[model samples]
Target: MEMEKYFRVDKLPHIWCPGCGHGSVMMSIVKGIDKMGWDPEKVTVVSGIGCSSRAPGYMNFNTLHTVHGRPIAFATGIKLANPELHVIVITGDGDGAAIGGNHLIHACRRNIGINVVLFNNQIYGMTSGQYSPMTPEGSMATTSPYGNIEPPFDLCELTRSAGANFVARGTVYHLPKLDSYIEKAFGKEGFSYVEAISQCPTYYGRRNKMKTPLEMLEWQKKNSIDIKKARDLDSEQLKGKIITGIFAERDDEEYTARYDQLIKSVQGGKE
Candidate 1:
């Protein structure tokens, strides 16, 4: 689909597991960038350590593979330094919601002009099937052989409340919706967050009895409900359903622009 030029041919065989959904999520991001006709040189993709983090290596753009759970922090710096660059952060649930969570909230709070695409695979796919903060309660993982007891974070709601200008959630099964959400995020002027629910057949699905990638994808299709329809349903009816769609969008002043204005004001006031 003309996506080959967006990728590094040398990095052609990615290291993700067979049937992993991260590839689809990464494709959605690339598709969004391509649709916008953004220059590869003006775009910067930053990622932290995890299966989803490997995407930047494949993309033919300015990329940074940062330390575990810190891509948001690095991306923030990159945006602050060069407001003209389109900074897109590719982070996994383990890398984003666990340790890097603080950065995520604050970046949303400050309304930085960066796009964060969280690949929510639910389990730490690259680290041998460990449970992540987005892992649903009662889900089994290598670290939670008895089933995870902690409730998963509602990332879309979290980011929206934290002040992100745009917040949306989509699953790999809903490819078109996922692509639309990412494209909308890229077009937003302030902090934007897209939760791309992905599947980890090798880790999450296997341990949870889903077994195959198709099974996992089917599960997503059955469990997902759009936000517009979700509002009409009661909590009981919505229970166990993944609410997908944009939860928030507002025209708030972005951090970098505010900083630039501050600099101008200070300089103008100098006597």
Candidate 2:
């Protein structure tokens, strides 16, 4: 765990609000990359505008901070233009599941070689506590004073159904499990998605009466059940519970590899 090697030391002290779980989730990403032994020079991190998108600013690697909800698109292009590069996308609930949602689905359908780590704070924390696509029904937010009537998207299940080669979910409170999911996602040959459930104490907590970050973290611990144990429970028993674990993983033809084969066929092996 020589973290300095993977972080921009000059960027010491991030700007995330106190009690935010994003920092932990961001560290898990770095740990995954380090454990995989991937050369930083060959890795590229892309992000869209949001609290989570700031990760690339501290990461010591080829990085791109893109427009809101479009990091996946930018990452896909980078991967296609030079298939040798390992691309990772850091996006948030509002940035990924709302505006950039279509891009997320298509990337999964294409099964591209990119790792998408979504930091789901359940609210648009960067945008001043607005409700996001991942905000739970009946949740309070700047945009949902009367409680959010819309159901939240189960991002892991969405990606799994959309053809992602690997899909998983974990909470910031469960750091080791989160890190393991990310590491596994990085090792997949095709499109992989990991939803890191993060706490937004300043915005989400203050609005929902959680009072403190510790309370939010405790809520996650009490509500989350491993995917293995979840199977033994009925739907009623699982209600309001966060199921954390890998949902899908399969050996499939990756987008870049398939594109390369098509190019070879079209040019008789000449680039």
Candidate 3:
């Protein structure tokens, strides 16, 4: 089937730079939506300010371009108001892990049925290439001229510890795997976090010695290892390896479901 049918064609020529992997990750999301055959009107896409936040504008579905670092906050309200709708959040490393870190962690803690497609470009691509929470230690950005002293977030572990029902990681270099992860996230019952490590050649690459976008992707390909393979290796062997796969999944009760049950109990006593 033609995947373009899911997108608003007029919104073509997205604002992302050439070779930026955000486009690929967005396409994978669209393909997952196509697989689900969900009605556009029933799906709500929420985004914060960033290159990744521009995704909701290109899609034909119901969308909300919210304030920076606040997509999850808005998405929470959207889901709570209408439990039947499929709410998805699109956010960036800077927007999600940096300014929105509290919201991101709380969303997982609440186990709300919201799907979060987190685009981790490592650097702040939208606000002139600043160092983001996901920026690898030693990686150079505008804010980190010499090198970054801060250690990067292992997002999968963070979300899992925060109590998400599902957590997965995929790189733009692995499109099919990314599609599969998104599909799984869409089907999840509680807070779902899917991390997509995208490439920002224009900023991150130029600052980190990866002169071309392809070179950045090549680095991802070399550094990443499947979760299944990682189990066979020791922690020392796994160092510097980006582990990709679903990190966790659970059948815990979603927030709305539990709330509805509470309402039913109160009404039952009333009657």
- Per-residue lDDT tens digits for candidate 2, residues 192-259, read 99999999999999999897999999999999999999999998898778999999989899999998
Q: What TM-score does structure 3 among the candidates reach?
A: 0.96
Clashes of each: 0, 0, 0
| Model 3 steric clash total | 0
User: Estimated TM-score per prediction?
Assistant: 0.97, 0.97, 0.96
The total of clashing pairs for model 2 equals 0
lDDT of 1 at 91: 95
Compared with the true structure, all predictions reach lDDT values of 0.94, 0.94, 0.92
- Cα RMSD of predicted structure 3: 1.4
lDDT of 3 by residue, 95-208 (tens): 999999999999999999999999989988988799988998888999888999998889899999999999999999988999999999998899999999899999999888
Error of 3 at 28 (Å): 0.7
> What is the C-alpha lDDT profile of model 1 across 1-271, one tens digit per residue?
5756799978878888899998899889999999999999999999999999999999999999999989999999999999999999999899999999999999999999999999999988887999989998899988888988898899899999999999999999999999999999999999999999999999899888799999999999999999999999998898768999999989999999999989889899664
